[model samples]
Target chain A: MSRPVSLPRWADLALLPVINVLVAFFVAGLVVLAIGEHPLEATRILLTGALGHGEGIGFTLYYTTNFIFSGLAVAVAFHAGLFNIGGEGQAMLGGIGAGVAALALGSLPGIVALPIAVLSAALFGAAWAAVPGWLQARRGSHVVITTIMFNFIASALLVYLLVDVFRPPTSMEPSSRIFGPGGKLPFIHELIPGLPKTPLNLSFVLALLAAALVYILIYRSRLGYAIRTVGANPTAARYGGISPERITIIAMAISGALAGLMATNEILGVQHRLINDFTGGYGFVGIAVALMGRGHPVGIILSALLFGVLYQGGTELAFDKPKITRDMIVVIQGLVILFAGALEFMFKPALARLIGGRG
Target chain B: MELIDTAIGVFASGLRLAIPLLCACLAGLYSERSGIVDIGLEGKMLAAAFGATVAALSTGSALAGLGVGIVVSVMLGLIHGFASISQRGNQIVSGMAINMLAVGLTALLGNAWFREGGRTPSLEGAARFQPIALPGAEALAGVPVIGPFYKSVVSGHPLPVYLALAAVPMTWFLLYRTRWGLRLRAVGENPAAVDTAGVSVSALRYSAVVMAGVLCGLGGTYLAVAQAAAFLPNMTAGKGFIALAALIFAKWRPVHALGACLLFGLLDAVAIRLQGVSLPGVGQVPVQAIQALPYVITVVLLAGFVGRAIPPKAVGIPYVKER
Candidate 1:
């Protein structure tokens, strides 16, 4: 057998991701062509829709906020070698928690009510994740399978609460009443005079703050060291006096809390009320974001922004070409996951041979 | 008499519902037994369901639909094999990719082609699989107790139902009795040992994955052509995951998988029946609670509140030979 060729850090981190993304888009283009649409025209529409005007940019950034929270959630868990697919459920629970707090404290001032709702969202998400983490830690269950199961359970719980508990008698829809003014986060347009009115809001700032905090927690903290050590090699971590089980639970908790913060953008900022399936598959999208970003905070933000562009652009494309619905973005997302994640090393050997030459 | 009628109805519905779960569980069983963790079973089934529906609509033949469904599913299985076996990639991530791709492609193509909001038209006549009735079903219906049971629970079903029932024993025999099955199971348990024995680990894994694809295809065809008669967007819902839970609950054994699938199917049937109806002790049971029972049970079992589920030894790890 031949020895494996190694590439420099720049090629490994920067070059490979760009190549993979280009390949994904190339395949997505083929899909567009297969459906009797012009891929180039579609791409033009997407780019212009996402970046052409202030409103488009605002929508893109607004979507980017939710992705950032979910992406950071996946990255935190990834650092601990846990694949936390339950972000969907955790985010749903976060919405429920935020809804509960806002509805209960609706009469209070925004200074008091809003912060309580945000904290409630995190606490609820953490608690939902802690159960699966505890199960995996104590009983030796695989976190992946357990988290997947929890996603279903969480959705069921969400539906039950919406139908039986939250829905007002006067309303027929399975959703809560519109939240009070105190509960709603101020829109970004309100703060900045000239910006077009979009769902973009203060949660975008919160998402950035969360990203910075995650960077510090993962790279600068002692707990982060233990988490990384356990992830890399559990037997070695155990030998070095770190409890892998404890780290697993803690990492999952933090991951779930980050996922929960997405509600600050979706529920508190945009919808201002609890609704079903509002997470809109963004939690699953986070997996792609984290994988494409290579589990780094900086990479996650960039990838999240990319997905935001796809989402905002896809919506615009749908208006121009009914044949190309938002599902096109999902296809692109899948291709990205395939090339950038599962087949990540497919280009490595060739690239190494090209760069380093014969050994 | 009325009580007996209700019992027969529930049992019949339960059996019908169990076919898809049983087929998918068996599909997972084959792949996992050969060291490939196939979380993409859901994706494969969903794609196959769409493929089957489209082919049936075009050809007006249910068998043609089944053929196309199997081909589509096997293609996806090959992709998974390429990623996990050849490229030595993360099996879970590969499976995830397959799932998302299937979800997106099915909806996108279905919408573009049919223009019914991502749904295919309802299948009818020759396009749908008609239930087969046993020779003595009518005669048996006249007798007491066993008559209705035999007629409702044992007699009439589409071809896929019987195929699913037979797959269990076939899988068991293949896994435990046949030479190829032994090699496949050995590769899953310890691929290096199989390689040392001069048998090809990748070949065995690829075959197992192909077999999984065929079975999932049958399951998906059952959903669109036999069970539902049309392809609905996200129609598989979480049945694939439910089947996965059943696989875990069964401890990866074929006979146990049948039992587990039946148990879950029965729960589903009961949940459907109990909706909007209040019982004496339980009151009006929330549908979601019943729907969540299978997942909760799987989690508890995984936590070892029930028996332990030890998977195949080398499952999820890529095989790489040492120099």
Candidate 2:
């Protein structure tokens, strides 16, 4: 299909990622074997638990919806050459935003409340990200370090808010009161009949729409060109009349907004109450998703879905095979990140030799 | 007078808490000064802490534990070097990978071995670094403020604290008062020039990273065997990042790093002290605000609202030879 056949586009785009994932699974299988579990049976269990039935698929999609937001968050920043590791913090802030919105507008109809909640989440997340972005763009501070610090700060802030300010007098838990009926998001089954009763909601469709918007913004817009240019080479981008600082801030804000959108899945779709640590490491997992996806929208969707499967499947595996605990999933995730990111080129030379020799 | 005594006690605790941070900051200083950004400092420290705890528990020897810690840390260091220096991969990604691997591996192994929900058994007596009193502590007990302060703050820490304190000056001497320091500095600032000067850039970076690992080992050992008796999951608890912040706040200087670590340590102590204290006018200050104080200050510092941090010029860049 390729004219000169240097390395087929399909191989570069699809084969390598699949191969890396396979390697990760292979190592994970060995780990399972070490723990006296059958690897082949484990795989079957993971897949079936994640995707075999309507209820399992619903849970998987619920998780996938969250990952899509975070993965896109990382990818947007990647396009501008900034590492937005603060997605965790930003998403937490977004949860707070959702809480505040529900509290303020709980008397309104669902149609009115949902949009306000979504807007609030995105705005709150963007504000959180903007500080680091401004520091990087205007003050020459490193975004990565500032964002990491912000994650801790965000956690602290959330704990204070939930415990001191928002905690219901009747409740002992460090979580806000449940949302009123008007503020609650409709489940997917309610929106469309005959589906399983699960946490899956309108947020999944929102995620898909957001993906489409991100694709258009990134691949077909002027700002996208400027972001890509700055990421590729700042000096050249500057010479070409794009302001690097402006692009950096804009890109980071967009990343943060995307990350903030993740709150709708947990706060609106599932829990309907703001709780501490609700993010549950999804922000960090997003980094792996972004890297595995090669920072592309399509790739990100696929990777996010893959991680969602892993999450649901891993839970099942742990429950079924108590010896293969949930921590084993983290080990497999780490292996995937290690191979896909740090050792990305380990197989490239061999592949090149094989292709070149064959041709 | 009572308030002053409380303050002194807090200072002592702060000093104790500062030891691990001091080691980590020095480790980071060496690695970054050699132009290799080592975000994996947290990962290395955690791995070392686990190794130290397990080894100390098994062998009944703190020294063996320290050796195990250092070896594990150095192995992580070598992995970072291979990824960043050899393969020319992204330093941040590699560092993050190390952190993830360390966290996942430690929990998995700990759960498999002890089954106490991913924590090592608490060490006792010989298995841990016990606090040692200086020779004159008893004699000076009768003296006033200075005596108690010295005895509590400076004299009775485990050996690792003293070693960590001593490491500051050693690091200073190595970075400023030696030929090796100059070459290391040159490599970070301009690897091309170092290469032109016939020194191998990769070798310098690898050495720096390995040195960082050793320092991280001491820090981790202090955490597990001295600071606490067992290795808890996420026991490092972002101290590695705090150390990085301290390094930046110190502008990558050894002596300044000591001050930075102490300041963060003091912040932590104050946060603990302020947790439940009620004030007359306002009310109790929330612990979360105090807990977040250091990071807020760091953000302000990074924003250049205070001082600027200019990293090494060649940092995060692979030194590629011209063909």
TM-score on alpha carbons, each prediction = 0.98, 0.96
lDDT tens per residue, model 2, A1-359 = 11223467877877777787788779878888876789998888899999999999999999999999999999999999998989999999999998899877877898999999988999999989988998999888899999999999999999999999899999989999988876788899998899989899989999988888999998999999999999999999999999999999999999999999899899988888889989988888888999998988898899999999988888887778776677877777788877788877767666777877888
Candidate 1 residues lying further than 4 Å off, grouped into runs, are none
Tens digit per residue, CA lDDT, model 1, B1-323:
89989988998999898988998899999999999999999999999999999999999999999999999999999999999999999898899899999999999999999999899999999999998998899998889878989887998888889989999999999999999999999999999999999999889999999999999999999999999999998888888889999999999999999999999999999999998999999789899999999999999999998788888999999999878
TM-score of chain A of 1: 0.98
Give a tens-digit lDDT track for model 1, residues A192-250: 89989899999999999999999999999999999899889999999999999999999
List per-prediction Cα lDDT, in the order shown: 0.93, 0.89
Q: List runs of model 2 lying over 4 Å from the truth.
A: A1-8, B280-283
lDDT of 2 by residue, B67-109 (tens): 9998999999999999899878888888988898888888878
